[model samples]
Target: MIIRTQVSFSVTGTHFTPSKVPAPFSDSHDPGVIGTVGRFRGAPVPYGSAGFEAPEKEMAKIAWIYERVSPYKSAMRDAGAEHCTLSVTYTYDSQCALSFSQEELKMIVDLDCYFHVDCQTAT
Candidate 1:
């Protein structure tokens, strides 16, 4: 017997504000490809069709998360003193899975999941 399962999650966190706005600003957007595989009974199965379409609204959400979290890390010697850490969070829905595979398990961690801002530091 083969069984299918669909898993989904969200990502959220607090990102420190950068001293200056970073270049190449990417609008909140979900990844073009955001699905994986699963197992049924005992065989490998695929999920969703090829070239899945992401929700338009999701793009905005993703961009927001990325922008808000960008300031958490500082590479410059004098990146403006940590101004403030902004709360960031986003949720991603995984495409349904029809089969299971070892590779699929490895990809689970990267799945679209909710993120919560726990804490942060400003220099």
Candidate 2:
């Protein structure tokens, strides 16, 4: 069972700084060679990211952030970013199944962003 889930969106590449990626990002940092929790590294520039998380709600977390970024796809690409992504991570206590509905996948396709999902057993 999934104990918690988080969904985040990011524009990252080796060319542009976070500042160049435009506004509305909740997290930003310079890239590093080694990655740490919540900090994406090794791009040599910066990562601009934003996330949406809610406690105890059943609504899909990805929906909460979709509207905010959907309109900026082109602008973000114009910022010299080589990639835009929607990353979902699930923390589970028992079984963790990696699956997605067609609608869920369509959202990612519409945004032209990579979809990355990770599952971890709760310790």
Candidate 3:
């Protein structure tokens, strides 16, 4: 049952909350492909498409969280608990995703739905 939904979560008890940024009714494709509009060489560039300077934004919250916790042992784990929490939010067109892969289904389910935190820590 796919529906428009906004969900928030506390990252490892950190002060970051990934909230959903609602997409306008007339949204386009490649949400992560962030770019600016300008002239390249001689041709005009689009915003939604890739730009020459910046890279695509994927798992934005994860990236931000990494930046905050990169110095610690258990980067994510410790940051979410080491100091004051940071609030981070992410919005999506759909609430959740379901994948079909017999070999890796268990892992996907555990990480996605079960919230298994026993995975490997940052090295």
Best model per lDDT: 2
Residue 5 in candidate 3 has what lDDT? 20
Root-mean-square deviation of every model: 19.6, 4.7, 17.0
Instruction: Estimate, for each residue in 29-88, the C-alpha lDDT of model 3 and write its tens digit.
Output: 222233343434344322221101111243333333333333332433322322222222
Q: Worst lDDT window (10 residues) for model 3?
A: 46-55
List model 2 lDDT by residue over 11-114, tens digit each. 77665455555556676654433455543443333443333333236466665567667766666667656777778888999998767778777777887877
RMSD (CA, Å), candidate 1 to true, equals 19.6
Q: Give the candidate order by descending TM-score.
A: 2, 1, 3
RMSD of 3: 17.0
Error of 3 at 66 (Å): 0.7
Off by over 4 Å in 1: 1-21, 25-56, 59-64, 67-72, 88-123
Show how many residue pairs clash in every candidate, following the order shown. Answer: 25, 1, 15
| Residue 68 lDDT in candidate 3 | 31
Q: Candidate 3: TM-score?
A: 0.19
* lDDT per model vs. reference: 0.28, 0.66, 0.27
Q: Is candidate 1 or candidate 3 better by lDDT?
A: 1
Q: Using TM-score, give the best candidate's number.
A: 2
Superposed Cα RMSD, model 2: 4.7
**Candidate 3 residue 110 C-alpha distance from true site, Å:** 18
TM per candidate: 0.20, 0.68, 0.19
Error in Å for residue 24 of model 2: 1.2
Which 10-residue span in candidate 2 carries the lowest summed lDDT?
47-56
